[model samples]
Target chain A: MIRIANGQGFWGDSVDAPGRLVEEGPLDYLTLDYLAEVTMSIMQKLRRRDPAAGYATDFVDLVKTLLPRLVEKNIRVVANAGGVNPQSCRAALRAVARAAGFGGLKIGVVSGDDIFDRLGEILDAGCPLANMEDGRPLSEVSERVLSANVYLSSYPIAEALAGGAQIVLTGRSTDPGLVLGPMIHEFGWERQDWDRLAGGTVAGHIVECGAQCSGGNFTRWWEVEGWDHLGYPVVEADPDGSFIVTKHEGTGGMVTEETIAEQLVYEMGNPRRYVTPDVVADFTSVHLERCGPDRVRVSGARGAPPTDTYKVSISYLDGFKAVGQVTIAGPHAIAKARVCAEALWGRLRRAGFTYQETLTELVGLDSCHGTIPQPPSHLNEVVLRVGVKDRDRAKVDRFGKEIAPLVTSGPPGVTGFAGGRPKATEVVSFWPALIPKELVRTTVTVEKAAG
Target chain B: MRRVPLSRIAHARSGDKGTGSNVGLIAADDRGYEILLARATAEKVKAHFGGIVRGVVERYEAPNLRALNFILHDSLGGGGSASLRTDAQGKTHALALLMMEIEIPDDYQTPYPEGSPSKGPPAEGLSAPRRKSR
Candidate 1:
């Protein structure tokens, strides 16, 4: 059996968590997940500004911090911090490792998930790239697209491990792919081993969010202890594809059936067919029980081969958007907030700029659940949040300028304006679609840093 | 029949995809599941959400787990980075569903061992308890 732990759930997760994972206990492979759909466009924009600035710089720095411990323990790392540019991320890590005297470090860089430049060609070649939400073709928003990536599987990552890479980095890999890759490399699991592959996918799904399975953001938050030092999750895999979910010994996170169950159904749809590039994992087939304190045993996962197409996350520059808010307090809070919003919209329109979309909400009173069935009479304060989105940047920008005047011109009891005017920002939207398996190819190259 | 919020007997979790969102409501036990199967239909869920959801609602029954999954199309204004709302991903959407008042048969007892709504909605300032991740 091998022990795998996920330290970083997302790119912006606490940096200290990874170091804590290393210092706390024994781990064979440590995985980190970094990319989100819109993050691809953000990284692409950075790359456009500077070729070397696309990937997560925090990860590069963390590697420098972890080099000594990683070398002493011989622990391999798998991370998808590559964002839109795995090659650049590999170079940055190589430079850092070479300087830090880790000359023998064998780094694996996986690429080809990025298809930003080739999207136009693909669309021109009869690929509709239809939006998964609606059947609209990608061509409608093709000109505004920023970055396009195909979610890759575990094959390239496993190949990297087989090539003796101590650290594997990939661009746009599936979250569970980071875990599935190590399992494949360690146990030599075949592509056709659908059940085991399914098991591995489930294992990855549980730990992919790091501290989530380890007692963070649990629904029954009152039952969980050690909130100050929440430990990330680790999975123990056997030859039969079953695994035990646990955190490091003596760590501060609870691993109970409830916690595991919560993570099992999170951000999922159609429980029976949780599709990935690897296999179709049956979320309902899996069994969960509290085997021990801070430990849960997971087994009996069913699986099937994946579909013929690969899901692509395409991000585009939708439009410009801006939101600004001010607090209105003392009697008639909801009414006053609404009045402030109406005044702001009037000001924006009078300036000869109408937005494509506008939204107004009394945040404290009815923002989340929609219009309240009944409003409390004693309500004291509420924030007035108003926003606008438009293809014309000037309109969104002009909308931001209308907030502060509401304090004096519109309603009374208006406060909460510590920050300057909210500025217009580009809104990057996601367009998820699929392409045939034959249209994309992934490659992994393993090499040592040159001093 | 007495009217009470669904949270009296069930727990829920929600998430988003593009403009859509899904809520998974799990009954506390066998009795709760039977009650849920009878009352928590897709049309009812759509009605509960009303204008908050912009498209059709789809339901999947998980009898083995005593859970019902409801997909609310166009639930998120635009979802993810595209959405301008505070809860763009609909992380708190399940709580909104839990606040729904439902009809129960006479002599119905909540399966939840903790403080449950045998009478009406959960107390004010009471957060819809459960977990959110992913």
Candidate 2:
């Protein structure tokens, strides 16, 4: 059996979690998932500004905090903190390790997931890279493409582990692939071990959100015992293709079957077929039971081979947008908020700037659900959140300047406008497309850096 | 039949993928699951979301877990980073769908005997994550 813990859920997740995870208990592998679909474009912009700024620098800090324990406990790390640039991330970590006087650590860099440079060549080969939803081809928006990366599988990562890499860093690898790769290397599971691969994938999903499986954001928030002290999730994997999801015993959070079940459905599309880079997991075949306190025994996951294509996340320059909000209070707060929203837009229209899309919502009443839910007739206060998106950045900037004027110009109850003005920011739009698996080649290179 | 909010019998979690959003709803019991499969069709969900969702709604059943997954395409204006809305990542979409009222048998009650926490707390503090949405 092997123990794997997911400490960092996202890039800006609570700091000290990863170091505390290694310091708290015995752990074999520490996996951190830092990339989302649109993260590539942001990282691309950062890379353009500064050559070494693409990766999540927060990850480097976390590694520095845990450097002593990681070497002492022989705990390995697998993280997709590379973002758009894996080599620079690895080089940065190497510098950190070298400065700390640990020269025996080996960092395995898994790159080639980034296909931005080769997108044109691939397109010329007759693949349109059509948008999965709109059916429009990528060629329509190729001129604006900023970043295009193929979602990598576990094979290259597994190879890195087999080559004795103490830490693995990847770019654009699937979240579950981080766990599955280490499992394949340790258990020596074959590529055709579909059930085992599926089991690992399910285990990864359980703990991918950190505390989500360990009592945070649960449906029954009241029933959770420790609200202040929450434990992150850890997976205990057996060679027989089953895993037990649990947290450290004295930790803050509870890990019952119900808690784990809640995370299983989070952000899920088709329950029966959860597609990862490695295999297509059948989540319907999953079986969960409460083995003990803060422990959920998970088994019976089935799977099949993956599809012939890899889903590529292609981001482009969509436009610019700016959002501003003002608190409207008193007897007719909702009505006053509505007036403020219209007045802001009316002012923008009169300024000869028509936006591609404009959104206006009352924060307290209909912001969350839009028109789906009905609010009460009277409300004490409402925040008028208004925003506009347009191809022209100047137009969005003009809309931003109009929000604060409501305090003196339009609504009687408008008062709480604090921020100077919401500046127009570039929109890094996501375009999901598929690519033939054979078109992209994944490579892993391991280099020793720290002791 | 009697009218009741869908939250009386189900729990939901919503998230986004590109321009699409998915709301996963799990029933309290098998009886509630049966009610959902019978009433919460794709058409009903699409209609419930109305203009907020620009595309079609697709439903997938997970019988073992007593859950239904609804994928609403073109739900966000574009998606994270690209959408101008406050809830760009579609974080509170579950609460939106919970407001949907459904008709159920008058005699059939929820499995829970006491207070209904499943009704969900009011939607508060919806913000898009700058670094990551998942």
Candidate 3:
């Protein structure tokens, strides 16, 4: 049996969680998932600006805080904080470990997802980096691309673990890979163990967000107890691939059927066809039971083979956009908000500030559902959120200027327009495409820094 | 791009509020999504193109459904000026479709992977020393 704990849910999760995880209990492995889809692009921008700035600096700080306990507790660490730059990320972590006087920490890095340098080569090879949506090519806004990373799986992570590294870092791997990698390590689970791999993937999904499964974002949040000190999730895994999902006892948050259901529903697609880099888990086969306080036994996950091509996360230039809002109050507030929206768009059109797309909605009034939903008859107050998007920066900028004028010109019940003119913000877009796994090679290397 | 599991975000019905709706741009990862908050309009725009393209932008809302698939159609802009598609072009189209933005927490930082040397000694009592044989 392996006691695995998820310390950090994302890059910016609670700073003290990782350290607390090691200090508080018996944990075999400490896994952190920092990379998100958009995070890769941001990291790319940072890497371009400063060679060493691309990795998760927070991870270094967290490592610095937890190194002693990590070493003392025999807690192995794994994370995909590598974003677009794994080598740089590893070097930063090495520096942090050295500063802590812990020389020779075996840190492993998994990379090769950053295909930026080979963009043209791949295109020349006929990959066409076409937009999964509109079929647009990258040449449209290639210059504006801040970052490009392919979704990698747990194979590299397993290699790193097998290579005897104490800490393993990765660029853009699937979230489940973080948890699945460790399971692969302890149980010697083979890559072809589809059922076992799927089990790990399901377990990873359950604990990916730490406390989220333990009731962090419950809609019936009021019913939850001790949320202030919510306990992160822990996975007790067996060689058979079945695991128990629970949180540290004496911690805040509720581990009930409702909470589990909420998380189960999160990011879920086809209950039977949930695909990841490792396996396609079937949620329908999953069975959950509350065996004890804060302990939910999760088992019985089914899975199948993964897609031949890895889905890539591509973010490029979309368009410029800006939004501004105002609260409408007093008699016929809904009416006033609608008028404000119409007037704002009308005014923009009259000013020749036609955006490729423009929108105006009254938060509490109009159903805001594409069509002007019938506002509640008694809605005396509503927030008019108006925004626009266009390939032209000037148009979006102009859209921002129009919002403030509405407070004085559009209608009587306008008020929430505190943040001056909505600034023209660059639109970072997403492109999901498929690439043969062979085309994206992941390399795992372990390094030891001098103290 | 983060794909919002339809089951999770099916409850996310934002259009009723006004002119634009909060469409979840599901990515392979959650990389720039936080920044998407400030750039929500881009996500919204991407959502608008979901139906027009030949493909699909997965969006499903059912009690039994677990994820939303925003099946994107042909918004990749007809493969751009060159018939050949570059990785950048695909990513650009994904971003172009974004319309709604949500603010990521201020503490958000990007994480990356690193390579470590193999000659390091093991910790005193925690894990066993590196095994030479597999």
DockQ of 1: 0.33
**Candidate 2's residue-wise lDDT over A1-451, tens digit each?**
9999999888888786787788777799999999877778889999999987898888888888788889889999999999999999988899999989878789999988899999989999999999987899898899999999999998898899888888999999988888888898889988789999999999988888889889887766657876666788889998767999988767787998767877888889888889987899999899888888888899999989989999999999988888888999887888888888778878777888788898888887877677676666777788888888888999888888998899999768888899789999988887899999999988889989953
Label model 3 with its docking quality class.
incorrect
Clashing pairs in 2: A102-A450, A102-A451, A103-A450, A103-A451, A104-A450, A104-A451, A105-A450
Candidate-wise lDDT, in order:
0.85, 0.85, 0.66
What's the TM-score of chain A alone for every prediction?
0.97, 0.97, 0.92
Question: What TM-score would every model get versus the actual structure?
Answer: 0.94, 0.94, 0.75
Which parts of model 3 have CA positions greater than 4 angstroms off?
Answer: A130-144, A366-375, A410-413, B1-134
DockQ of every predicted complex: 0.33, 0.45, 0.03
Question: Which portions of model 1 miss their true places by more than 4 Å?
Answer: A372-374, B104-109, B113-134
- Interface root mean square deviation for model 1, in Å? 2.9
Model 1, span A1-451: residue lDDT tens: 9989999888898788888889999889999988877778899999999998789888899999998899899889999989888899999999999999888899999998998888877887788999987789998998898999999999899999999999999999899999999999999999999999999999999999899888887655656778888889999988778999999887787998767776777677888999999999988888886788788989988899899989999999988888888999987887787788777777777878777888887887778888535555546788888888888887787788888888789778999965888888999998899988788878889999773
The parts of candidate 2 lying over 4 Å away from their true place are B104-109, B113-134
* Rank by DockQ (best first): 2, 1, 3
What would the per-residue lDDT of candidate 3 be over residues A393-422, giving only the tens digit for each residue? 887787788778877787676777896888
- Comparing 2 and 3 by DockQ, which wins? 2
lDDT ranking from best to worst?
2, 1, 3
**Using TM-score as the measure, what is the rank order of every candidate, best first?**
2, 1, 3
